[model samples]
Structure formats: C-alpha cells, structure tokens
Target: MEIKVIAFDADDTLWVNEPYFQNTEKKFCSLLEEFLPQHALSRELLKIEIENLPLYGYGIKGYILSMIEAALKVTDNNLTNEAIEKIIGYGKELLNEPIELLDNVEEVLQALQGPYRIVVATKGDLLDQERKLKKSGLSRYFHHIEIMSEKGEDDYLKLIKHLDILPNEFMMIGNSLKSDVIPVLNIGGHAIHVPYHTTWAHEQVEAKLDHENFRHVEHLKEVLGLMPV
Candidate 1:
C-alpha cells in the first residue's frame, strides 16, 4: 500500500536532546558526589525521578527540581538558600542552550514534503518541543505537529482516528523501539525504526527483530529511498 501520512519522533530522532540532559546530569552528578557516593547517588536519583514520573513527566526543569529534592531527601540536609540559587542558575543555563537538529533532517524533510503528508508526533515538554520546532526552521515542512506527554497504544490509536487515516496507509518513523515502533505495529500500522546512536534511558526498549510490520534503517534520510512518492 502507498504511504499517505509520515509521522516522526522529535527529540533525539531529529535533533540533540538526550545529550543536553546528559550534560546536565554530569554537572548534577558531580555536585551530588560531594554529599553521597557516586553510584549510590545516581541510583537513588533515578529511583526518585522514576517514582515521580507521574507528577513530573519529563523535561529539564522537572528533572532539575527532582535532583534538588532528591539531594535534600537523601542527605537529610536542609537545602541552603545558596545551594538553591546554584540549582536555579543551572536550570536557566539548561533552558537557554540552543536546539541542535541532526544532519540531513532538514534536507530529507524538505525533499519529502511535497509528495507525502509530513507530521511531527513528538513526546516531551510542550514548551521545549515548541521551542525546538520554532528554532529548527524545519517546521514549515510538517502539516501537523503533535507534542504529546506520552507515546502509547492509545496515543497512536487516537492520532490515527483523528487523522482519519488507515493503518495500512500510514508510516511512523522514529528512533524509539518501544514508543514509536511497538505502538504503531500494535495498531496495524507500518513503522520504520531508525536506531539512534544515543537514546534516552527512559525511551530505550528491547529491539524486536521478527516483527512483520516494522522495518529498520540506519538513518532518517533513508526513509525517502523506501517510498515511491
């Protein structure tokens, strides 16, 4: 079947997202090491953040706050006004960093724009995604941009229904195996997995090699070669 709608995953799929988090985590981890053992502190922070996912969702701002709260809780230290100020300063730095779009993302999207219906179906902070989209200068190619809090079976199902597109006629292209591939395949849609070099810890999932509807590619630009139009 000919593909009609081409959906994409934002964040690390098209740009540098997790790296920024990694950088922030490195800074946080260094400070944290002063109060707690590095390994213990890292594990505890992960536990706290994961536990708070329902409340915090995902983003730099929420993550920074969680780190601060975790430090206070784990050390039993009353967070000093000075330390709070440092955290706030780091948060501002994180927010101000420039968005980095991956190589060939703009070129590939622009090439495929006229022939197919392009859409960005990303899962992340609304403000962050919006900022990246606006700054990337590739937003014009997409007819639809969806900034979702989460990517699951229901989310994909709802998008399919809203777009009024058949499962067979749609393609979900993304770097995630769990969020992007499985959900699309579960809904009877075609999905292409472009394995990114670096994936967020939360977004990582075991790769399924035997899936019939799922295809893998080395790069985002490779999608154009697979399609007729």
Candidate 2:
C-alpha cells in the first residue's frame, strides 16, 4: 500500500504489440511454406529467435534477422532475392507501426499519475522503444523512462537505485510474467500481470506463482480499484 513508483512495461502492456508481430509471423510462415510446413517453419523461427537473443538482443531487427535466417535454412540458401526483399519489407512495416494504446491505458495513467512516480521500465532496442513511446503520446505521464536491454532482478535493482526507491516501494505492471512479473517479484517489488490476448512464445511462462506481492488482473480497468484515488 506504500508503493511510491509504478513502472509499466511498454510493448503489449501499454499498446498493441504481440498481435502485430503474430500477424507478421503468419506472413513469414506463408512466405516459406513451400520450403517447409507452416508449423515447422514457425517452430524453427522461434528456435532461431531464442538462440539469437544474446547476439541481437530484442526487437524488430532481431526478429527480422531470425526470419531471414530461417528463410535461408528452409530454402537451403536458395531463397530468392524477391523473398528477401519481402522479408525486409515486413521488418520495415513493423518498425513503422502506429502505436495503438491499449484499452484504459491513458485513463488509468491519468488516475494514477498524481499518486505515483510513473515510469516505463521496458526491454527492447532503445530507438524502437523510444519511437513507440513517442508515437503513443503517453510519454508525458511518465516521470522517467528506462529502456532496458533485458529485464532481470539485477536490472530492476538498478532501476530502483536510479529512482531512489526501495524495492517494496516500487510496483511493475506488465503483460509478460516472464519479463515483468517474476523479475520484480524476485526483487521484492510488487507486480501485476495484465495478460494480453496474444503473447510471444519468448514471453510465456507457467502460471504457478507463490509471491505475496504479485497480483493478476483481468484487464487494465481492474487495476484502478487496487489503490486509492
């Protein structure tokens, strides 16, 4: 009840993200379906993504690289120049996507803004996250923005230090349990999981949680009732 900072994860939490990526994945699978079945290519792309996470980090650029790599594998290095161009086009489309804020995002932020030192603590390419935040028009609500390379306990600890808030005095709201909830909970911060309709395979986690500081909400609107007005 004494939380001083409320940090939100940017991607799916604030705006539509995974669904766009899912659609792009479908386009990708279709593009290479002749080289391999849709299901197989999808799995292969995920495998490459997870494998490439360290080198490329996270975001559209990494996803594009994985797609190109998968295409090469599926077609045995015989992928057409046109196909490569199309894949690059997919990445460009994702990068140029309009920010569509999730339901109640601005409303809830408006409600909580005065009471909380709101911030964005999200993981992605800095340029891309900054671009999305700029497009969302919600940047003014946040006191600070932390675009992380990764979200782990240490990262949250560093953020708490930067913000000069105790772990117990910080709360994180996000769509990914793996990236958002677990790390905050592990660091003794509060977290609420606001599940999105679609999730990337990399962000999925099993639901057997045992942390007292963690809560799950059916929607962003429900989060309003958890604190004072």
Candidate 3:
C-alpha cells in the first residue's frame, strides 16, 4: 500500500529533549542530596512525581516545583516566600530556553514534506510540548501536531481513526522501542525505529520486534531515503 500519512515522534526522535530534562534532574537531585541527605529526599521526590503522573503529567516546570516541595517537607527546610518565588522564576527561565534540535532533523522533515502528509505525534506534558514545538519553529512542517499524555496501541488506533487513515497506510517513526515502535506495529501500522544514542530510562524498552511492518534504522535522516517520498 502507498503510504499516505507519516507520523513522527517529537521528543528524542526529532531533537534533544531527554538531555535537557536529565541535566535539570541532575541539578535538582544534587541540591536535594546536599541539603537533605538524612531523608533520602531525591528518591522520595521521584516516588511522589511518579505517583502524581495522572495528576500532574510530565514537564520540567511541575518537576522543579515538586522537587522543591518534597525537599521542604523532608528536610524541614523552611523555604521562605522569597525562596519559593525565586525557584519558580528559575523554572520559568528554564521554560524559556530553546530546546536543541538534533542535526538534520528540520532539514530531513522539510525534505519529506513534499510527498507525505507529515504529522508530529509526541507524548508528554502538553504545555511543555507546546513550548518546545513553538520554540523549535518546525511546527509548520507538520499537518497536525498531536501532544499525547501517553502512547499505546489504543492511542495509535484512535489517531489512525481520527486521521481517517488505514493502519496499513500509516507509518510511525520514532526513537523509543516502547512508545514509538512496538505499539504502532501491534496496531498494524508500519513503524520505523531510529534508535537514539541515549534514551530516557522511562522511554527505554527491550529491543524486541515481532511485527511484520516494523523497520529499524541507525539514523534519523535515513528514514527519508527508505520511503517513497
């Protein structure tokens, strides 16, 4: 079947998203360790964050504040109104910073735009994804930009239905084995997996492929070469 819609995952697939989060996390973890070693603050905060996923979703802004709150609770650290305000200010600054895109990502997308109906199917904090998409200036390349809270077989099914495209005619391209590749394959869509050198722990999964429509590659740019467009 001739492919009609080509959907790409936004985070690690198109650019350097996980690294920014990792850097922020390391800084926050260090701060917690230095100030509140007695309570094992970082671990506790991570647990809280995980428990709050349904409530807060994913994003650096929420994460920063959550860390701060957890630190205050565990260490008996009386964060004054001024200190808390300052931390919020820092989080805002972090949000303003430009997300670094991977090399040739925009170029490759531009190259592929002429022939395929390009769409960005990313799962994350909606606000953060919006911020990153706008900042990257590549939003125009996509026919539709979907910011999903989660990715699974059902998500893929719903997306295909909404787009009015058959599973055999859609291709999902992404970096993670779990979110990007397996689920799409299970739903009978073609999946092109371009492995990133570094993957977030949560996004990583076993490199297992049992679907006939699945394809794996080493680089992002090579995807354009494989498809008709």
Candidate ordering by TM-score (highest first):
2, 1, 3
Each prediction's whole-model lDDT (CA): 0.81, 0.93, 0.79
Better of 1 and 2 by TM-score: 2
TM-score of each: 0.94, 0.98, 0.87
How much is the lDDT of residue 149 in candidate 1? 72
Task: TM-score for candidate 3, please give it.
Answer: 0.87
Q: Supply candidate 2's per-residue lDDT for 63.
A: 93
**Tens-digit per-residue lDDT, 20-103, candidate 2:** 898999999988887788899999999999999999999999999999999998899999999999999999999998999999
- Across residues 95-196, which tens digit of lDDT does each residue of candidate 3 receive? 777778887898789888999889999887788888889888998999988888788899888888889989988999999888888888888889999887
lDDT of 1: 0.81
Off by over 4 Å in 1: none
Pairs that collide, model 2? none
What 10-residue stretch in candidate 3 is worst by lDDT? Answer: 30-39
lDDT of 3 at 229: 63
Q: What is the lDDT of residue 34 in candidate 2?
A: 78
